[model samples]
Target: MPIAPAYDWVAHHAMVSPDRSAWADIDSTGDGAGLACNWREADERVGRSAAMLRDDFGVGRGDRVVMFSMNRVEFIEVQFACARLGAVFVPVNWRLTVHELDYIVSDAAATVLCADPEFGDTAAELTQRTNVPHLVVFSGAGSHPEGSVDYDDALAAAANRIDADPALLPVMPELTHDDPLTIMYTSGTTGRPKGAIITHGMSFWNSINLAELSDLGRSMVNFCFLPLFHTGGLNCYTNPAAYFGGSTLIMRTFDPGEALDLINDPERGITHFLGVPANYLFMGQHEKFATTDFSGVVTTAIGGAPSALPLLQMWEKVGCPLIQAFGMTETSPMVTSISKEMAVRKAGSAGLPGMNTAIRIVGEDGNDVAPGEIGELWCKGPNITPGYWNNPEATADAITNGWLHTGDAAQMDEDGYMYIVDRWKDMYISGGENVYPSEVESALFDLAGIADVAVIGLPDEKWGEVGQAVIVKSPDAAGSVLDETAILNFCRERLARFKVPQSVRFIDELPRNATGKILKRELRG
Candidate 1:
């Protein structure tokens, strides 16, 4: 029989490649115990977990179960269990505040929440206000909160005997290509967050595209350090790696030194790595950076923020080309990427659209713009999301005529190479002249004493809005003053006079949302 389009990867892999290594987690703490699981073990655990969800917790088809934890072996197992049982998995960002977590749980209508002990306090505060009926704690050495179930104990309570027939579980409904599979909440850099409804087909298609685009075969082992709650980490890396029968070296949390150690480890056989630019920046500056060997890694995917040209050059100096990609949680997180070959030639451009994708630049009048003219980027593809979970007005506004309006202003060259200017909402008009923050941020990146910088428009009575550059000075440049004159002088040489920042403020760090994207909304405030 042919494999179903809505195939369960855990079930398929267990049947086909039972003995293959599926996932490995290194204990960063000095416990001397690491976690490893093969396809067979993963499938059994997921199945047993699913039975527990059904029999014990009363979780079944169409129910929402939220997983609040960092990267761990059980996270993947629980995700698979949810998938197999036709339940929706909502992975909450552990970094969110209690109020934020409460809002999401209430908004998503998640009935069950599986949390790690590390977040017990946050979960306790949220559960008090929300309607969450069940709480299961995993990987915690501490006592469980009252009315909460221990994850390991729950799993053990379920009979260890496998289901009589692997296919006997409830068949996933005849889902349209657009039916919701995962509801990933937006990072909410601008305002209140909304859940982006990712469909089963969207996730599966993007994973297939990524596997083919990156040439990820069975022998490849991918490194995942980005939070699994984010689309780039979950759909792009973990889900896809499982689809192709490849292995994933799961990092519970992102740490530059630990990541470098994992990359240099010969036993892990890590061939593919993906991370945000901040990770590369830290790793490149580490004391042992030069001596670390990355000859085994064939591809390094970097995104989530604009990488400095200097940082890319630094990685190149170490014999690795960081392929830049651009996508949001709404795009199934794989919209466009700079191919390995083009990474050298096009330093900052997020390369052409992937297979089966269409990209166009539209002006305020909703028509395509000419080459080199900045306009809002709109994308349409199988991978593009149908709409936000609820909020029809927002959905209608974001998706018009079947194209997902990206809200990012960009320009494309004659050869179809695209360059991101800035978010449409982020671009400010000063003195009747357009100012893209990315332009100023790029220039700031070249400055000697800058570690990080974000440009925002401050309320100005004269120019309507004046540019304010908020900077985080490098550790070496600490205790030194970075006055507005110095920044203005630096920009005067690189940018037009009107585009230069009118004011400069020294900050410890730019504010960022859960996904690590700079929160200009907070910065403006």
Candidate 2:
């Protein structure tokens, strides 16, 4: 197969189909605040913003810009603008703390920072610490700091026409297949976050695969509620939607009532939807869920955590089959996905790998494991990241030969279906957000009277796995009682709110192995 040369997503969309609906923000509150833009409008905004960035903000090719915001129309527009300018886009997870946020911004060396009103306070704090020259506030409603510029104001100042000098402009670069496009910071499980360097070819190939696999094209309508910062949302929703010229219903935040209303309405044209198990669980429990008609839903992809059998059954009863999938940020996020044809047969499996993607279960010695035997999941494909940014040692350890070592314990059946058994890393995913045990442990260490802490995941009815911290306090701290609120408050300052432990238990001592390693398995009991 001849490899197609790389092209920026914005350039590709503008050249191919300029009038198709590229993105839209659905009004979850039923207000008229919803925003929608077709491909032409999206291209114009990106072009205008690119020109403004070059002339006003001094951004050019190879420069990095950080976009910190929730799931909104502007979030997608900023990404397009970055691509148009040939600048590497770094999207910060909005839930991260000031410390984590500052680390990523500095690491990316972002010359320009764009933020939504909700994150203005954190952005203001970051601007004080970094040499970022420009700050553009989105949503048009925020009180800007003294030096910041309004996003709408910048767009207004931009020329309506694209500049003639394509080479002098940012989008004219000859983007090779391997050239870096986006640097996504993985939700670090054990230590500080690592930036996964993604290329134009890798992202484009994954989007094509997803579009073909999910039967998404110009005729399909996709409802995207996942955060664009995550691979699941970007590759699956935004990229694929652009690839097929399909319409997308975007939501800045996931609301059960609003989601139900959108899916049930026939005019919404929602044929496909994707979310984690927690989303399905929450929607399943909503009072209107049972009454709402989901007959129009063709496919619903559920992942992040295992989907409970009961939840699957509930969706099936409403004529919507749930397909479970398994992937990580490193593999361009799509490894194995449950196919619609095998939806009922392979109830728990994450299906087989897509075209040209290989999956294997390897033991400690790097040999393949037998069928039905548990081992670390390893993947090799065009979609896999070349390596983690600026971490050669870690990258060497992670990618053996060409296979990306996924720190997930999984089993494969005789028919080649993969089933997730457990995670090798001590990472708990609550409501689709990756919560690292080390990050939570570091926060717990700051508590004044804390002696030792071990954080583990416990099965929950809503969130697939809620964080449970078992603390062993000092002898003098025996009389000190620790509650959920106190421990959560302590974490809020150092970590994201989602990473905070939902429950805290004061134990005399945590189970430790002979080598003094905290035994999380025993702690789970």
Candidate 3:
């Protein structure tokens, strides 16, 4: 059955359980100062924000409101407010430089821009290039550009008016299930970024997929340390948990030590957690990692990229089985995920196709391959984006015959589990054998003294290309002076000789994008 086209989960939950905690935000100061809002409070705040956007900025249906800030409750509220008014919310990556941000803001043609105090400088620079008419500083003590208002003041004004007479707020436009909900820009690993048009229905279905896959319940307490701009943080678990009447505790930004303390705090009672593999890696390497207790966590998920086997084993050793998922921004960010029950049994598999999701592994001939044969994975589902926001050429190239051809090379076992081997473009053939960097990195991560690692194929004379490993050795290993020979020998025991990295280089850290995904392209360069 289709969800009601006009239904708003926030509004629905606010009405059904007015007193239930909807969202919680931790301060970035790392002092544990935080704030939370119940459903009723959230509804009122969202309504006020909608009123403010409509009245103050003339923002309404089809208009874009760009949020360039770090994670916070206001970020989520602004997004919901945009939903309430049928406006598209574009959450810019705060990690982006001013030039990159300018392209997104102008491309989006956003009328209102919101910034966090931490990014006041970037936001200020953006106003000079983009024609964004209204600027609001959301959370920070730093001074904003001229003519900007404090986000809190804007909301308070609206709330005061609404409190006196709720009827003053403009009537929300009737929306269909297909109304645009968000315009999430891709990470642009290969080319210029393109906004993926996410619809209300796409968000709804993705939440359903998450709830079913994770067994999310009203009692689950989700800790969201991932950035909200990404689908992993927005639609993956946070939104789904909210839809199920569960509470989400969000960190203003990921602080490894702070996250560790939260997980150990019995009062927080964190039951569900989600992050990229790098987040888990950093947390595991933190000084207190060995002493922290993660036993209270009922569900933990890893996305962005496949996690290393050693990282998986580390978390499992602490009684927190980390389930790996495969997705991208184009598919409402979730196509397949390993369920908690099967986390250990199918440790590396991306799991089964999600609800209302179909998968096909197609070979070069454009035909379905036999089970266990590697091919490009194509997905068709309600959660898949309609198309890229403005680039029809890119959209046409991406979606065909109702299937989004995810540029991921994968294999499906006889039992129907999907193992994402590599990005189709990332796989390199060496001596007629296919070598996936992820596979090699997983083996290297299993070594006793490795902290982080990235692998890329480099030109070779004997073979067309050979694997090169870039590693960040653990502190203790550095003290012991672990060398390339140990890493190569470690791989020889666990992998085919041909698949082991032919060369190794040590680095203080790996180059990563804002979302904690290692930039292999940078490594290759």
Candidate 1: segments with Cα more than 4 A from true spot:
1-4, 28-33, 161-176, 188-190, 427-525
Candidate 1 lDDT (Cα, 0 to 1): 0.77
lDDT of each: 0.77, 0.79, 0.81
Can you write out model 1's per-residue Cα lDDT over 32-53, one digit (the tens) per residue?
Answer: 1256889998877787888778
Model 3 vs. true fold: TM: 0.80
Q: Where does candidate 2 have its weakest 10-residue lDDT segment?
A: 160-169
Q: Give the best candidate by TM-score.
A: 2
Considering every candidate listed, which one attains the maximal lDDT? 3
lDDT of 2 by residue, 338-363 (tens): 87777667888888887758998999
- TM-scores, each model vs. reference: 0.80, 0.94, 0.80
Quote the positional error of residue 69 for candidate 1 in Å: 0.8
Candidate 2 Cα misplacement greater than 4 A, ranges: 1-3, 28-33, 160-170, 475-485
